[model samples]
Target: MVEVERLFFMGASQSSSSNSNGEVVFKTETPVQFSPTLVSQLADRQNASPVPTSERQSTLDDQIRAKIKDEVGKLRREEEAVQKQIHTALEKENLDRERDGAGELADGTDSGIGAVKSSAALMGDLEEIRGKIERFQVRKSLQDWPQVRESREKLVECYRSHKASSLECWKEVEGFKDSVRTLEKEYFKTLQ
Candidate 1:
């Protein structure tokens, strides 16, 4: 704890007097004291040792390179394992084909990947698919457009008859619109 006192100056009193030169003398009071307080945290950055920028960056780069090399090695090992599995599967398939008395591959090659086919076989498969499609495909019945044709003819006749007053063909135009709407409804029903 600390004690505090304030000082102030005023005109000279009876105890205080002006100097010989007739200048008014100023008087000072006791010193002012403040209460003790908590100290604040301070950062002494000047005393700290900092790592060099290039060194920090190089360390980060080395870590990244090591991680990449590890990942590459792992991927290469996985690829080799997959290759081995594929070769084993191919061997099993060849054994099966031999037991089934099958001759060479359809493409005439005995490679690792054995699914290549001749153009002739591909054409034969396409023809077979086409035959099946034709056999099972739904044949669209002919949509007789008699109503639409009649309405269209009527509209054309009305236009021709009233070339100067085409507004007189409004009934025929409405008839044609109704016919088209009906045709669209029937088309959608067939789709469903």
Candidate 2:
């Protein structure tokens, strides 16, 4: 004879049985149902309000502006630190060269080749650091301009436009960036 049974589990259940044929069976099940009352309760929960597109765009713009400002400030700080390092190096090199000169004079053997080479190397390093600072200053100046901000905004709009392809906006973006680069180069050249 075959036996049949019915069981109801609220959440989850695991059952094992041995049939008359000596075969073992295991079954696991989870009983879940969405009740109308639960649905009504869920519907009653307050949802987060959505920000308007214009407000969101303005917020994004503000964030971008702040980020650019932060980046520029950081670059300026780094440039200042590099300048300080260069100055410190120059001072230390001068002091060392003075000590070497004094020692050589006392020894009656003055081979100033080493000192000259070191001074030349130090000058090269200082020049490189000055170039970096000049470039950074030029970039910061470019970023500070209102026209650059307007161009950026236009580029952003072009990218965001539904009818425009991103590729189409690349020219404007590259043009503005190239202009900034050119300005930096010209400014650096003037320094030289």
Candidate 3:
């Protein structure tokens, strides 16, 4: 039989020993103790009051609003600075224009008038192009003329009738070609 004893750092002790009959016995000493300050601090923590949910929520809301106000103020200051810079640049440009005797730079109305003139010119150009396109669409092809159409039909009929002897259709072919040439000459004359 063997006997063993153990001691813990927190002031507790455990011992095991064999009795005369070979049975084991265990004994434990006193539990760990706490300093007075530590005990008082733990007691104080247990008794401390907690903030209510509504009060905590309101404090958080106030903090968020303060942050938003700070950010908006920063943005407004930046915007004002930018506006001042633009005004200064415009004033400098106007002074330069006055020195050059260019009439202190034209206002928005003058530029608007120029824009209207440009738009009117663009409309005129568009109208001219449309007229040209209409005229081209209206012009008749030589094949559509009455004399040319008649001769072409005759030539086609003659070729159909003289399938194996296409030479016999020479007269009709020559007549069709002559009609086309005449129409072409008239079209060119009209252009001149």
Candidate 4:
């Protein structure tokens, strides 16, 4: 360790040390030490990298998830298209049947409304059936769609049997009747 002082020269050390017309001088030297733990930590973090397999698996999973989402969207679209076609076909069928029938103005209330005697019990039954189908409907395909078809037929029969005597009311309730068919179809489709 060597220090230089401007206030003192060679062989000059006393209460007032000086040099040739010297003033004062200061010396400062600081030593730095590297701790072992700190050095190890720095070396350990030299190359920061994630585990390769985990990263690779995450990438693979992302790709799979994207593919599945795309496939599900396509499937949903296809189902909707097929359903629309089926509904259109059903509508055409009903229209053809009506056209071929006798000259009926579609007013069942006149005489086709039948006896309104047990109408209360029948209405109660219909209401119960309606309760079984609120917000969700069962769906099925042609091969094993007997139950959905049965429910649909029964609903239509109920509508026809209890059709409003007034044409105006009948027209309005016809919307609800259409919903029944829709529910049946939707239910059957969901079942598949």
TM-score of each: 0.28, 0.29, 0.31, 0.29
Q: Which ranges of candidate 3 are over 4 A from the true structure? A: 1-135, 138-144
Q: Which stretches of candidate 2 lie over 4 Å from their true place?
A: 1-52, 103-192
- Model 1 vs. true fold: TM: 0.28
Question: Best-fitting candidate, measured by TM-score?
Answer: 3
Provide the global lDDT of candidate 4 against the true structure: 0.64
Clashing pairs in 2: none
lDDT of 1 by residue, 38-122 (tens): 2222233433546557989899899999999999999999999999999999998866766443334657555444332444555
Q: Candidate 2, residues 63-135: lDDT per residue as tens digits?
A: 9999999999999999999999999999998878766664354556875554434556669878999999999
Question: What's the C-alpha lDDT at position 158 in model 4?
Answer: 63
Q: Estimate the lDDT of model 1.
A: 0.73
Candidate 4 stretches with Cα past 4 Å from truth are 1-52, 103-192
* Prediction RMSDs, each to the true structure: 15.9, 27.3, 16.9, 24.3
True lDDT of residue 36, candidate 2: 100
Cand. 3 TM to true fold: 0.31
Question: Comparing candidate 3 with candidate 4, which one achieves the higher TM-score?
Answer: 3
Candidate 4: minimum summed lDDT over ten consecutive residues — where? 108-117
What TM value does model 2 have?
Answer: 0.29
